[model samples]
Target: MTEIRVRDLRTADPEDTAAYAAVRRAAVPALLATAASVAYSCEHAHPDARYRALVAEADGEVVGTAQVGIAQDSPEPGQGFLNIYVHPRRCGLGAGSLLARTAEEYLAHEGATALYSWVLDTPRNRAFAARRGYRASRTAHFLRLDLARGGLPPLADPPPGVELRSAADFRDDPRPLFALDAETAADEPGDVTAEFTDYAHWLTETWRHPLLDHELTTVAVVDGEPAAFTLAHTDGASRYASGMTGTARAHRGRGLAKLAKNASLHRARAAGFAEAFTGNDSENGPMVAINQWFGYETYDTEVRHVRTIA
Candidate 1:
């Protein structure tokens, strides 16, 4: 077996992005990753987050990758994340461990007292994390829909006093959508709490992301205010993914989230996307049911794992 060496992503290198995205897409089938999207992430990363993407190479081939960063938006300090992925065919070649060690060292040096990782819910993956002193905390499911054939629900008619619109409609002023997104995100189930208080930061990191399709992201409006929304991401190919689906607190139980998601799914199918994917916290029952109603099936699951740097 060739020795695996880990290093930071080469700056402005398209080849590096391509190699990194390839590993990610192969390891996680439900992810919507493209070289362009990878480059955009590196280019626009916030300084506060201390984002660093590392690739593990073996005989000049990228065999694994890791994304390490601080949760800058979290109200708490010292929160960091490190999600690592190795080529499915190249597991056990030491790439994963090398990448993990490198990421852990960086995060700890950067003042992170704890590290969180998403491990695929498999016997091998769970064992690996356990050996590293990482304990499971929460579970998330990845769902996939065959847009070319999945029996997607018909676009529903908006209920009384509600209007369906796309995120593109608010390109001039997205603050309202930001507010809705922040509120919903704050309520999401997660180990690290994120507060999306920075509007300019949100626009730079999310609204303008390379994979985000403003035209396909459906937003439900009530009395000129955003009630619910479902964001869409595309790989510039026949693949699409739902970035997020959220409904304001006051609008929960009204199925506004489902309404927005349905509209987005229909539009995505019509746009020639062959497949669609999404993820939900295993604890989020309502969203899980909504996705199931739209013909989505759980293709995979990942367990959130945490380890302390004492």
Candidate 2:
């Protein structure tokens, strides 16, 4: 076996990272990937993000990569994440182990006390994480919808006092969406709780993300007030992704979330997106049920694994 070396990604040769991302997309079809996304991530990473992308090479060829970073926006300190991906054809060359070790050292040096990673729910993958001092935490499922089939529910006219609009309408003032995001994110299932109190950061990170398709994103309003929304993202291919969907606390159980998502899906299909993808925590029954109603099927499962470094 050839010796494998892990090193930080250099911006000089973009083709190298693009190839790395290609390997990831092939290994994990549930994820939305593109060369632009890879480059944007490296370019727009927050200063406090402490981001470090590592690529593993063996026999002079890149075979594996890992994205390691601190959860800088989390309210809790010392929380970090390290997700590793190895090309399916290169798994047995010790690339996975090398990437894991390198990521851990980087996180530890950055004062991270605990690290979380997602391992596919396959037998071999689960066993690998268990042997490395990591324990299972939570499970999430990736779902896919066939937009080309055109079986989506008919878009219903907004109820008498309700209106529908695109997220792009709030270009001048996105605080309303930011507020909704902060509330809904607090309820999401995760090891590290995110506090979306920084509106400026949200504008720069979420609203301005390269893949975000504000035109297709739907926002529901009642009595001229924002009630629910569905954020959409696309790779400019035939694929689309539901970035986030949420209803305000005051509008729960009113079917506003479903309404917004349906509108977004309808627009996506009309725009020629053949496939749509979304993910949800296994414990989030409401969202899971909503996705099922849209004909999305669970195509993959990932188990969150956590390890304490200190």
Candidate 3:
């Protein structure tokens, strides 16, 4: 077997982006990723985010990839993340381990006190993480909906005080939607806490992202206020992903999130998207139920793993 070497990805190389996307798609087919999305992320990463992409090469071929970066927006400092994926056919070639080692060393050198990663729940994957000193933390499920075959709930009329609209409606001014996202994100179930305080950053990283489809995204408003929304991201092919669906704290019991998501799903299907994907923490019962209501089924599961630097 040829020796496997891990190195920083040449973000400017199209071949590198294509290879990274290939490994990721082969390793985790349920998630949405493309060469364009990969390149755009690298180009527009936040300055404080300290993001870096790495690839493992063997016999002149890229067999594995990892995304490493700090949770710069988190109120807590020294927290970092590393998600590594190796093409299934290339597993057992030491590419994954080499990539992990290289990523962790760099993050630690950047002053990270703890590192977190998402590992598939399969026995081999879990054991691989455990052997690397990472303990299991939380589990999340990747759900898939067959937009062409599965049934989506019929869109119902909004309540007397509520109305449904597309995200494009807020293009002129998205501050209200930003405010709603910030409030809902604070309550999301996760190991790391993130504070979305910079609207300019959000505008650059999210609103202007290449994959975001504002016309397909749906927002639920109550009395002229953005109460809930479902953000949609697409690959311009037949793949669609629900980036996030959230309801403001004050709008909890109104079922606005479901209303917005249902509208978004219908719009995506109508737009020729054949597959829909979304994820939810195992502990988030409400969101899980909502997805189930939309005919989404669990396609795969991954557990969050954590390791503390001594």
Candidate 4:
């Protein structure tokens, strides 16, 4: 018989936390993972977020982990998210089951009426979620680009009075970027709508995130106004991730998003990053096309699952 226990993460044990992140990166390549990111998430999560980092241990060895929390920023009350990951080599030890049960119980206690999760589209993964009563909602694709080998389109000069800049340049005043993000995010396809009205929250959760690389993040400015941007995140190693790429409604059709992303990718490859990753909703045709144009090939797919607790 195997015994499993769930417990919170301890920052003091950096190696242990890194092992958890390693498993996640291997299992979900689209997700940007690093020990620093894990620690920052736990420390900087909002006071009202009710976040919990549960680790599953079997026979005194860590085998799985889960992140459970209330969607504090959502306008809809009682909405929550839980993402669980178990080591591939350690499956069948009941670690995943223990982690999922603990996470669901925590969300329920926090008054969560609906829970959302992402599971790989593989048969085993899908079956696991189905067995737990989670119904499929939508699907997204993970894409990768061989920046070190793929032929990126030639960098076109910005139009008259337009220029390319880095997010670092706006350290003194990121409000312009915030306004652009708010406008673009409103048009993004998703089951849950997001209202980017809180600038302070965005600053804390996004701009200040440990993995965010402001210097490599590319932004397109037209007439000295931010019109589009491609945010970059890195693990300070060989992996780089495209966190979000969006253009203001007014800036669409001008190729501003492509320009920003191309500039960012060139910079990343020049900086020694070997692997680049990004994801897009299956319904987001424009973005999917943009990524495909950049030589990104579909590497994996995940289905969004939802369960109503109420």
TM-score of each: 0.98, 0.96, 0.98, 0.97
Q: Encode model 3's per-residue lDDT on 1-310: one tens digit a residue.
A: 5889988888788888888988898999987778888998988888887999999999989999999999998999999999999999989999999989999999999889999999999999999999999999999999999999889989899999999988899999988988988898889999999899999989888888888999998999999999999999998899999999999888898899999999888988998999999999999999998998888999999999999996
Q: Give me the candidate number with maximum lDDT.
A: 1
- The Cα local distance difference test for each model comes to 0.93, 0.88, 0.92, 0.88
**What does each candidate score in C-alpha RMSD?**
0.9, 1.3, 0.9, 1.2
Please provide, for model 2 over 89-159, each residue's C-alpha lDDT reduced to its tens digit, 9 standing for 90 to 100. Answer: 88889999989988998889999999999998999889989989999999999999999984898889888
lDDT tens per residue, model 4, 1-310:
7788889887558987787787788678778878878888887887777998888888878888898898786788888899898888888888888899989998999999999998889899899999999999999999999877777788888888779999999999999998988888878898776668889978988899999999999999998999999999998988889998999888799889999999999899999998899999999999999998999999899999999996
User: Where does candidate 4 clash, by residue pair?
Assistant: none
What range of 10 consecutive residues in model 1 has the weakest lDDT sum? 149-158
Question: After best superposition, candidate 4 residue 304: deviation in angstroms?
Answer: 0.2
**lDDT minimum window of 10 residues, candidate 2:** 9-18
Model 4 misplacement above 4 A: none
lDDT score of residue 39 within candidate 4:
81
Rank the candidate models, highest lDDT first. 1, 3, 4, 2
Cα deviation at 265, candidate 1, in Å, is: 0.7
